[model samples]
Target: MPAEKPSHFGASARRLVGRLAPYRMYIAISVALTIGGVVLSTLGPKILGRATDYVFAGLIGRNLPAGATVEEVVAGLRAQGKDTFADLVAGTPYLVPGQGIDFDALARVIMQVLALYLVAALLMWISVRLVNRISMWTVRDLRSDAEDQVHRLPLSYFDKQPRGEVLSRVTNDLDNVQQVLQQTFGQLLSAAVTVVAILAMMLWISPVLTIIAVLTIPVSVLVTVLIASRSQKLFKAQWAHTGTLNGQVEEAFTGHELVRVFGRREQVTARMREVNEELFDVTWRAQFISGVIMPAMFFIGNLGYVLVAVVGGLRVATGTLSLGSVQAFIQYSRQFTQPVTQVASMANQLQSGVASAERVFELLDEEPQVPDPVDTPPVSASRGRVEFEDVTFSYGPEPLIEDLSLVAEPGQTVAIVGPTGAGKTTLVNLIMRFYELDAGRITLDGRDITSMTRHDLRERIGMVLQDAWTFEGSIRDNIAYGRPGATDAEVHAAAQAAYVDRFVQHLPGGYDTVLDDEGSTVSVGEKQLITIARAFISQPSLLILDEATSSVDTRTELLVQEAMARLRTDRTSFVIAHRLSTIRDADLILVMEQGRIVEQGTHTGLLAAGGAYARLHAAQFRGAAVQVDAEKQAGEVPGAPG
Candidate 1:
């Protein structure tokens, strides 16, 4: 298979950010709270540094001579050739030389720092809660949009896509996005603000020291960029493999019965293992590569920290900076490195979110089906007069149906019979407008189908397909699926008409028994009867039975045919017949071959004319012909069981 489309990092990131537009007010509040909290928190170290200075000055002041001037203290230290110590002492807020530390002043600064931090913590806590709320609401809307998008997509989109992969993209990928936004959004914003605020504080104290603290930033960025580039591709591949693995597992389970009958259990298992291993490999690589970012950032940050400490201490001793300022600068250096480290770590997680975002955006960006016309031309009253005028259609390059024209008059039972792949089902599909005609028009009661809304067109038709699909529901609910607002009495009547009442009476709950999603509790024939009842209750103007009676036993088939015959009395009907005998009594028998109708007439008349219909009839009844002849000699009924 071709490689999954590579996600453009910048573009996907922009789109991800765009999802926050509707929640901008909440996001703004969160951001304001985060900035305020970060600002106050960054101020704590500077204020605490003043407390350090006061304590240090008090310890030394008591040892000095009493009533000493600031210059006297410096001069005395210089006289003893203690120039650096003198400079540090001179730089301090000079207390009277004999006085002890100012306990009251230190206490005041400490309380201020505590108050700032407590308020900062409160703000941050509240912001985090708000951010989480916004994240949930955003994801909820995103999931809703994805669900709506799936419905609007054309049927051809599903024909090419796997059900499981699409489900994974909508479900699994979306969950990943939600997690990333919830966990990372608030923290990232706080870290970013902390970095900026701390950096500014550092610069305010000493630009030289700030430069030294930030020297290793270029290396940290390089590490993140290099690892993230490789990790992104791996992350994308990991998600793609996850979707593929899910598809493989779903396929295996749905087809498990066939696989067991064909003895291909080992084959299916091997295929699953292959996809699982691929998923495992890509996930491991993605995690391992992204994991390298944090350690690399920490090493770079530690190097910057050491350089800042050495320079800061020297500046204090040289009297270019106050003791408190150096202490505060050292705190700022540590604070700065922390935010940088956090940001680097979150970069990897952001890449994962971006990959998932790409998947969702791909879904959202799918071309929807051509929109229904706003100004729908009103259709005539339902007479079920459907006509295809030189209809041409193709699934791919080659036309599947070319110049096909047919007319089903009101209340006529049209039976379409053909070999496999002869476009037997395609004819009905066209009438239902599943695929657009390539070069023709289909009309209902003289109005072009395109002129009317597809909903209105399909409302007049009811179909009973070969597969009797039933969802998890009561039998009554399953029958009522054809017409949701149908009364219980109508459901029962239709059930009785289709002979469903016969078997349902034996079921424990009758119409109310809950079936599994696959309807596996009921036998195949019973499921068919329920579906026929469903279509029967719909009371449509047009009916389509696509091999609708193929699953039942002969006796049940006859019963269903009888019921269908009654239902078909006053409606235009299209029956795609495989067992030639069932449609022998239809009003018109159409034989299709290679996208063209080769023959058309009544069953008896066509058989007598000896054309394609005769050949099909002969092929089906040759055994019966032989049996009858043998029975004539043996003096027994031909079809009687021995």
Candidate 2:
């Protein structure tokens, strides 16, 4: 079954943080640099304030140097034995009251402030680079773990979910996580450091002003909590709707031919419109609620700013606070509020990221396939023999197969014929252990099938399905997929046996032609031939052919039948055929209805007995005879044959 969707944000967040365990050193360095940068940045306003104080002092006729007197100048010149000193002091400002400003000292202070800012910029750049590296690597590991988890999940999990929805969890959901980690993580960290550093600097400047500035922090937090709480459900709904929308698009496009044939364009578009509308609704609501946080925070921050300015002005007038200190405090107030606003803005992204993480963690936490026993022995070589004794199974509460017993000895071809929904494919699945049986046991060569590893059991069986899937690769590669290390000659031999060589030789790049994702470059019949060739290359002891030639033309069916005959020559084969002619030569034929064997015999024996199989065969041939007669009557002239 598909995994339950995760709803616990705290657990998911913890899991996301746990991904950083391997990169602790890198994260530590990043944090250190961030702190250093914030500390240096906080020093800028204070240092500039010092420069302001110096300019004020110089302008107000305080702490200026005294001008050199004529005697003092002559003594300095005699002591130094140089006239340059007199020239330097001739137009120099005096360090005395009512003198010019100390331009040299002011220049030095400005340069000091500039240098601190430059260092801070460099540290912030390095820190951001480190953060990028850490986030990207963490996401890489996350994607890898999710992919490995997918491989461990049972087929039933896939059976229950839409392919696109599952894919969204793996791709779009991970992309969301990556975006948050890459962009929001650094911002949040910087905001935190900035807020703390700015607070410290503010307190140092004026405790009262610091208290006034910090009054907005609680209000901002409270507003943020309320809005974010409301938006969390909206964000979750938004992603879920997005996944559903993606699923619809994927299904519609995948079955494009069917849609066109059935003229479902209007219906499909209308359905997608509904889902799109739903997605848009939740998306906008989430954005609007989260968006309110920043401006609200700004409003409260501005109120605090007004309070600080008014209170600081009063203190300054009372001579308790310096003008420079007030200037610094005002700058500190803006700086402090800025980080809070930034953090408030990131609240939405953080919420979205947590939602995505929850989805990903759900996939990771799904129950994996049952594991093999620790001391499971390797499969021993055996003559092909399969047995199902009182086997029972079900998809739900209703039993699909019950008390089903069958046997196929080595070199025997057992043909299974049935109508649709008669558990034909389910039987194949059960035999392959794709789904564990609810009751009874199956054995191969006297050894219980469950005792063998799935890998070992699957290695001994080859399947060719009706769909005939092929990947994007050369034809040679597709054929060799069944046995990866097969030689080129072996591949050619298999292709020749399967009649794939007939068409492949005519192509521009014989056996080397690359196919697209669906292998649509070739006809369906040709694709089926390629799949048969793939099965040929495997050379398994047991073979399962499930409606393998049901989709092909008569001529292609002939070729496929010939290939299948060769494939089943020395193996125990189970053939599920809709066309009775294809299995007329089987050693045993089982006719199934409602998931139970209604009759079991060879074709002639069943015909002579006039049972269910005989009735079905008669109906098919009777239809064929009537069609032939109709064609003959249409082709005949008035009196030509008489």
Off by over 4 Å in 1: 1-4, 94-96, 101-103, 623-642
After superposition, candidate 2 runs with Cα above 4 Å error: 1-6, 62-96, 624-642
Clashing pairs in 1: none
Q: Model 2: C-alpha RMSD to truth?
A: 8.5
TM-score of each: 0.93, 0.90
The residue-by-residue lDDT of candidate 1 on 129-201, one tens digit each, is 9999988898898899999999888777888888889999899999999999998989888988998999899
Q: What is the C-alpha RMSD of each candidate to the true structure, in Å?
A: 4.7, 8.5
Q: Candidate 1 at residue 31, lDDT?
A: 94
The candidate that wins on lDDT is 1
Assess candidate 1 and give its lDDT: 0.88
What TM-score, to 2 decimals, does candidate 1 have? 0.93
C-alpha lDDT (0 to 100) for residue 520 of candidate 2: 93
Show the colliding residue pairs in model 2. 64-95, 64-96, 65-94, 65-95, 65-96, 66-95
